[model samples]
Target chain A: DAGITQSPRHKVTETGTPVTLRCHQTENHRYMYWYRQDPGHGLRLIHYSYGVKDTDKGEVSDGYSVSRSKTEDFLLTLESATSSQTSVYFCAISGSGDGLGFGYTFGSGTRLTVV
Target chain B: AQSVAQPEDQVNVAEGNPLTVKCTYSVSGNPYLFWYVQYPNRGLQFLLKYITGDNLVKGSYGFEAEFNKSQTSFHLKKPSALVSDSALYFCAVREKDTGRRALTFGSGTRLQVQP
Candidate 1:
């Protein structure tokens, strides 16, 4: 509802293949985040971008990489897909600072399966 | 480190009955607590947040959460449950001391509202 869209709503790929997911936002927020949701682990942050070309890793960023070359787009890439990497990926954007305190706005989500 | 816990994996409630989903948090400094809901095949949606205010915070879809400092808990509640209320709920926490604004999420709780 916050003008966010995730490409490839659903994707199925074989193991060891590379894959990339895209998140586009029209809100022009200052922060973008990539997260993976799996059973027993709710959701874990993979990476986040506070600005263009400024990215940081999260607790579970080992097999994932992210790029934010533009304000409206953020990309998440899996170098070599594994069965364990199969999960629902979500992209979220939020404003900066503690002013609004509003939570992040999430995209519809991308469901990926590595078979 | 900041962490949140949703003790129950699932909760069942009949239509029109009051419902609650438990959440507890651990943080180094003051905590910023939030609640989110996810429907099948959709991304997480923000429900409410407790930054620094009254203990009771109201959110969307007739949902509210009570923040208890002594207990370090923020439990989500609804006056009456509806079938549409059935979904997965997540609790998140952020620590004031940490400059990293990333949120830590709980394992999630599945709510089932039966008619």
Candidate 2:
């Protein structure tokens, strides 16, 4: 409960539609991350932001983009949704050097279904 | 490339018994190891981490892990298992030398505690 909140806890959309997921944190942490969880595959990083406007692609960033215009908010968008993009998305926050000493806190998560 | 492996896909234990989940990692420099738990439809929750210090690190929910440098292993352990402890566990690793502080996670192991 790091004062983190994710919008649209659950959603179902059609293929080719665009969708955006929001992750808001009150801790003001410097690092924000987007990850997707799926059965058998575990959690995979999609994108992350180290600072405002400083974003980078992750292992599974093919269809996802992230934005961090403010310290407290990180947004993840699917430019064009595909059925393969359906999964539970999570936002996590952490500070440099803490290295889990402070531990990374994750939002409740958003379940998206692409039909 | 930094990566982690959870050799076992699943583990079963009875209540009041001890449990162990094996995790091994590979990284260029000293590794930052982490354990996270996910339940049902929720997000990942940090269990513990091993940074720089004693080999044994204690974490939430009475869980602890030992960092074996020679073996490149960080196995999660608990003295007594509880039904509530059943969940999907993931092992993660990051290189200390890399300025890019993103974690590489293992496939995850499901733990089932029998009452």
Task: For residues B1-115, write the lDDT of model 2, one tens digit per residue.
Answer: 8888899999999999999999999998898899999888778888888879899999999999999999999999999999999999999988886687788889999999999
lDDT of 1 by residue, A28-47 (tens): 88898999999989999999
Each prediction's DockQ? 0.71, 0.67
Model 1: TM-score for chain B: 0.98
What's the lDDT for residue B44 in model 2?
87
How far residue B101's Cα lies from its native spot in candidate 1, in Å, is: 1.4
What clash pairs does model 1 have?
Answer: none
Error of 1 at A83 (Å): 0.9
Query: For residues B1-105, could you state the per-residue lDDT of candidate 1 as single tens digits?
Result: 888999999999999999999999999889988999999888888999998879999989999999999999999999999999999999999887666778889
lDDT computed for candidate 2: 0.90
Scanning candidate 1 chain B in windows of ten residues, the lowest lDDT window is B94-103
Q: Best candidate per lDDT, number?
A: 1
Best by DockQ: 1
Ten-residue segment with the worst summed lDDT in candidate 1 chain A?
A94-103
